[model samples]
Target: MLSNQIRKYTTGIILIVIVVLISVLLFFRKTQLNPVTGKKQHINLTHQQEIELGLECAPDMAARFGGLYSNTDIKNKVKVIGQKLVAVRQVSKSPYQFDFHILADSQMVNTFSFPGGQIFITRGLLKLLKTDDEIAIILSHEIGHVMGRHTTEKLSGFDILEKFKDSTHVITNYSPNQINSYITDLLKITFDSEEESEADELALKYMVEAGYNPKAFPEILEKLSGKSEIPGAEDFLNRHPVPENRIENLKSTIIKYHKRK
Candidate 1:
């Protein structure tokens, strides 16, 4: 009887393992090609899904900090600046649909973007910038984040999100903390390490290609370093902080691509 029970238990375990393996295989098979990033990605959200998600979350983001900037003219001016930066020939094929907004906050000193081209800048950071060059520098970096599909890649890791959606369970919006994580962690990570280096290089390229000074990015970086909110935000200004070699790498990339104009 004991032997019989052991056999039954082993068979059940094998069945469970097979089911899990099948589930995992199905999950991986859902991976699709990312048009923006130009790679096959494991993201569970479609392009339409990403657009809908960005549109849905945008309202709460604006409302969280007293809504968008009140002045329509200033809003239009900001949009114009962003468009100027994007108009560069190098970015013509970029998938970003830029929507520039100046946030109401007066303390945060950062400009950020979402996976599907949702762009935002705190008034604090905007007030700090002195010229169109600085704004272009910041926007170019944010555009890199959008093009890299950073948040979408991060969300792919949260298997719970994928599983829930896959299971057809109800979906609701994230709370403030969740939003912060996506903005600061997921999106930030894209701008944080190697990805950060890529964005910085892209920013410099975008600047020069736009006929603005190529040095604008590092100059803006120097300015951002002075009034950063987080202690390590200083490190952010320097794309490659740890090895201390990123600056040189950046310089080399700039020189190599200097004739890109």
Candidate 2:
């Protein structure tokens, strides 16, 4: 009887090992070439699926920030700038439909993008920007997130997939209990320093191509970074942390951009 028990335990361990190996293989096998970077990345969702997911989730996201902004003129301005940025070569080539919206929340200085090009900026952040170029810098950065497929790439991570599997289900099918959690997960989906840096670079490239001065980026960074020093700006600081090195890198990128022009 003891020998039989040992044989069963060993077989179970082997099965577990095989299952883990297969999961890893399947995860690694789902790679697609990034159009902008020209590098292969592991992405489980197709471009169409990303578009569908973003479209499905956008209304829920907008609702969280008190729905769309009220001012007609400002709303049109944001959309015009976004469309111009999207018209640039680096971003226009992508198979994504871009739309820009201003959230009604006037107390939060935040901006975010959904996969396949649904971008949003809060009114608080919008008011802080001084000029059209500054606005372009912010919008272009969100566009960079779309161009980089940062959200989808983050979702494809093995550990993230495990944690969000239930939420992922909610993404496709509405579950009253799980809806809030799914939106929360989307809010928490932020990029690391490296990814942020790439987005910054892409933002600069788009800004330059869209006929906006790339120099506005440094000013924009300084303007946003200054918020962290204020006591009541915790919300802005959390969502948009601007470290000194990022500014330094932006400066270097600007030099390279000018050289290419």
Candidate 3:
């Protein structure tokens, strides 16, 4: 009887702890500055905290696919192109150090970035592109993720995802198998489709703002869709994939900018 009472108390204490911890997180103090979109955010992290976090993971990130490229020429080329995409652009205004790299891997098609301005690509994705413009699009898309603070937005997502007692928390463990936590990873990726589309729009604006032809946006989308010349694409078609609709948005961006210009 005494042991049963003790077990009940322990369970109750654990539940109380979890509740308090989550409550503290929810009301976690946030700052007023918004760097990426200039809109206020409920983030409790400072820019310095963000920069430190990026640097901390950077080495492992570099080592992801054989410790970055030994090919200076290829690596330099990727950096040059990446710099051009952010060249004289708003993202260039970032005070933290900005660096770009292409991994030595041949089995990945992913392009991703870290908050402190670390951009990465796989040689696999590089070989897939038929033009520098396509490369620009990919890097800029990743950059869009950075400049738009999509990852940061996703961080908030973790907090939100955790609020539901049933949802629980699961993080990806990128160890021997890399995607050991694939389920949570995919769950986190289950963002509102509108965020994805908004990021694409920003990508187009930033690309053209960086002087690459905006057409590269849809062109790469077409290629990714795997049916550029088939009158419709398999990528991003939605339940009813429509490239023309997206193209129209890209086309009107300049006009919208000019109205503000």
Predicted model with the maximum lDDT: 2
Worst 10 residues of 2 by lDDT: 162-171
lDDT of 2 at 49: 62
Indicate the residue-level lDDT of 24 in model 2. 83
Task: Point out where model 2 deviates above 4 Å.
Answer: 1-21, 157-179, 227-233
List the candidates' TM-scores in order. Answer: 0.72, 0.82, 0.65
Question: Per-residue lDDT tens digits of candidate 3, residues 117-224?
Answer: 777777766877777777877787767766666565556444322332222233332343332232234223432444556667667677777777656565565565
Kindly provide the TM-score of model 1 when superposed on the true structure, using C-alpha atoms: 0.72
Clash pairs, model 3 backbone: 237-241
Candidate 2 lDDT: 0.79
Q: Which candidate is the best by TM-score?
A: 2
The lDDT values for all models are 0.65, 0.79, 0.60
Candidate 1: residue pairs that collide: none
Worst 10 residues of 3 by lDDT: 231-240
Better of 1 and 2 by lDDT: 2
Question: Could you list the CA RMSD of all candidates, in the order they appear?
Answer: 4.9, 4.2, 8.5
